[model samples]
Target: MSVHHSVSTHHHGGSGAGWLALFLVLSLLLLGLVVAIATAIGDYAIGLDTVFLAVTNGLGLTGADISPIEQSVVWDLRLSRALVAALSGAGLAICGAILQALLRNPLAEPFVLGVSAGASTGAVCVIVLGIGGGGLSLSMGAFTGAFSAFALVAILSNGATSGPNHTILAGVAAAQLFNALTSYIVTTSGNAQQARDVMFWLLGSFGGVRWPDFHLLIIVVVLGLGVCLYMARALDAFTFGDEDAAALGVPVARIRLVLFALTAMITATIVSMVGAIGFVGLVVPHAARYVVGPMHLRLLPASAAIGAVFMVLADIASRVIVSQQTVPIGVVTALVGVPFFALILYRSRPQT
Candidate 1:
């Protein structure tokens, strides 16, 4: 009887894994379809043939040069912005996954734990302080703020020494403190115009991205994602708690430092460029978990992919929501994310 039950359980697990792989492959195919459709829907619509021509030419395939308007639209404007959205989405989602594992909190999201607040602070510091950040000033400000917040939290929590408790508490405190700092800066600013711009950033947007940012976006997203993928198995060990993981000889403390630092850098990199788009990190990971179970190896990549799709779709919505007027992508995500979050919280409630 025991042997029969064990065999049955193995079959169940194997079947579940197979389903997850199928779901992931289907999701990837869907994303490709969305991208193909998206390139056709923006303002000044281009036909699929023209889009293909532009794409082939822009990619430097053996093709005739595109007309100037198509070339400018496809290569100079749309593709770069789309790429930026996708990369930022993927980065934020990856950061959320690691933070969730480290803290062991399903509610652990990048913005909620004060990462966005920190990055917002850094960005405002540069823009408001007249720091002469040159072309890359925005991202630099965001990265600096994000790293500072992580450092402060690390010092307070002692990084897994007090385990999850101190880390979460510190995150809460740092987030509030930094948000207050941002508000104070805006209120105290003598420059009214600068104050308004900073206020807009607090809300987040993809409108700021342009052709010039693509290189930086690609570099950070690729490097940060590669490193995170390398560390996924270790992050999985963390899900079982530091003690059990340590018993398994997983170098718990060392892994904590490496992951925390790497996640922060990735979050900062995205925040610096994309201006703190929310919900991708927080909501998308849970959505992926629902589809793929809680295994970090599968969860991290799936979250990144879902996140990319979510942001791309959100950006499209932002563009079309107001025909003559444009809404920010951040607003669209928040509108959708807050309610979904409430549902999660309500369902997660323990019944007496």
Candidate 2:
């Protein structure tokens, strides 16, 4: 009896560790896949060898011979966009996972709380009304707008008592209001060319992302991931509903507010940089949950990794799907997301 008990205890002890190791391995492999694909598939089409040489030389690892043009294309254009996509995807996915858990709603996503709409409105204001200067100024505007929308949602939802349905309704109202404001600014004030530019941004495009943008995105994603991981235990508590969480001494109200603010900040930062890429936060978390289950500790990192892979692949498809022109990243994400959304809905529907 003692030997049997020992064997069973040992097996149980290793199971969690085993699953975690598997997730980490899978995430690394996905990261590798995205890096390879992003480096290799572009207009100029640099070989894998040249791509590595350019990267290593840039990193001061080794002095490898490569042409200036190839170096510029790989280092400046392709690599920057790829890095931004990965970082943005990871940030969005983490936000979604946190939101879904906190709200106790599987459908909760980063933008569902109206952050993206607010960010878009802010960016449009900068572009059309000249509220702020170009570049950094636009980012600031978007950030401000995002938080403002979230503030409204919080008020309407009535803090901890609001529930998921109330929050979603409040979000919808905020989104419509901001979206309309964005349309008015673009149409009434801007010229045709400016309007076109704004439209592209509103729909999401990474065509103009540079090294500077990548730097900011990397900082935000790394910090957001750290914060989420730190709150992983609290997040798991939230999955069990407010009463249960409070019973566990989780301080449900304070923690929910903090997580909401963090998600808003992360979402706004990405939207300011990349023009509101959609469906990533909604779809990636669900897929990650399906693969890794609902525990936030394992779920957060897995979702980030899967989200990064999804965005990188989407960006690649946007570039190649049409020979001369690039499809908006948001459109690609939506096309992919709708199917997943349907499946989730179907699975979640109550049976007779």
Candidate 3:
């Protein structure tokens, strides 16, 4: 009977792995399709064929007769933008999934946990206040601020012993404090032009991203994903709560610290580059979880692919939503995420 049970379990695992492989392939195809569509959109629309030709031309695969301007737009401006959007989405969604599992809170995300707010404050300090005597890059400042906020949350929550609610409340307080700091810096220190730039960045924009940004972001997201996957078993253990995980011989405290730091690093890098774009983290993980189930190994990659697709689509919507003006990417995401957020809240509410 035991041998029969073992054989059945192995067969079931194999079947599940096959399904996951199929899902991942489909997700990648969908992501590629949307990224292509994103490249083909903009102020001066290019044909999809031209988009493909431009890409191939840039790669020296086939030097088709494409206009210099069209090639530049496709290869230089829009393609990088779309790729960065995809990477940002994947990174944010991964962070969200990791956070949700670690915190065991469906709503746990960088935005909700004040990591984004902290990073924003840090970024504005470098941009407006000239912190670090102009030596500090925005990314580093944001990283410092993000880590600070995570540390503060830990202090307030008393190292996870106070439970998820207490940690959430601590996050609320951290967010308010950091947001207030950002407002004060902008209002008192920044000139009109500086204020405008800072405000626009705060709202989020993919306008400035280029190949260099993509190169950096890709590294961060890939490393972060790898690290999370390495710790997938621990994350699964975390879903059962800390005591239970510890009882299972997991070093709960150490794992929590490392994962929290990783989350801060990814959140800060993205926030510094593109500002605080919320809800990708909040919304994408739930959608991925619904399709892929709760296993971190499957869920992480699914979230990354789904998120890449979602953000590229959102970027396209941002460009075309208004006649000439591009809406902030944050606004587009909020429109979708707010409704989902409300639904989750209503469902998670205590029953009478």
Candidate 4:
């Protein structure tokens, strides 16, 4: 009887693994399709066939005959933008999953640590105060500001020893401080044109991303994913709360620190490049968790894949939603996220 029970458990585990693998493969294929669609659409309106050939040609996988203009539009512009959007989405979602696990709060997200607020303040400084004196780019300034915010959070939370609540409170404080600074800089120092640019960027746009941006983002996302996957077991332990995680010999403080820094790094990179896009981190993980059943090993990858697909679709929406003008990617995400956010709140509310 015991042997039979063991066999049944093993069979169940194997079946679950197979399903997870299938989900990942399907999600990735869906992401690829969405990316192709994103590259194909826009004012120029290339077909999927052209989009494929152009991509294959750029990748040196094929020497398909394609016009230079179409090739450039597909390969040089839209493909890079779509890829960056996918990666940014993946990275943000992973960060969200990590933070939500470590902090034990379903509402927790990458930006809850104030990384986005800090990046915005940094970009504003570069844009308005001329802090870099034309040498410092907005991305660099934002990256610096983001790290600074993380550092401040670390100080306030006392390196995760103070617990998740304190860390969250610290993040809130950091966000408020940085947001106030950003507003002050924009209102007091920046010109009308500068303020307009700042506002658009703050809302998020993929229009400016190119190959270089994609290259940087891919590296960050890959590294973040690798590190997070290595610590997946630890994240799973964290879901039971910090004290329980420590009781499980999970090195609670150390894991929390590493995760906090990793999340800040990933979030800062996305925000600096893409201009503080919101809600992917907040929404994607919850959806992924619902599907994958909250095991970090499964949940993390699921979140990343879902996030990539979601962001590319959001980017497509942003382009077509307004006819001619490109809507801010952040705005598109918020429009989708707000309803989901309300749903989560409604569901998670205390029992009557």
TM-score of each: 0.89, 0.93, 0.92, 0.95
What is residue 21's positional error in candidate 4, in angstroms? 0.8
Residue range 132-174, candidate 3, lDDT tens digits: 9878987788878887888888898897566667778898999
Most accurate candidate by TM-score: 4
Candidate lDDT (C-alpha), each: 0.77, 0.85, 0.88, 0.90
- Model 4, residue 327: distance off in Å is 0.6
lDDT of 4 by residue, 105-200 (tens): 888897899989999999999989999799999899999999999999899888778877888999999999999999999999989999999999
Which candidate's lDDT is highest?
Answer: 4
TM-score of 3: 0.92
lDDT ranking, high to low: 4, 3, 2, 1
Global lDDT of model 1: 0.77
Q: Clashing residue pairs, candidate 3?
A: none
- The total of clashing pairs for model 3 equals 0
What's the count of clashing pairs in each model shown? 1, 0, 0, 0
Segments in model 1 whose C-alpha atoms lie over 4 Å from true places: 1-21, 133-136
Query: How do these models rank on TM-score, best leading?
Result: 4, 2, 3, 1
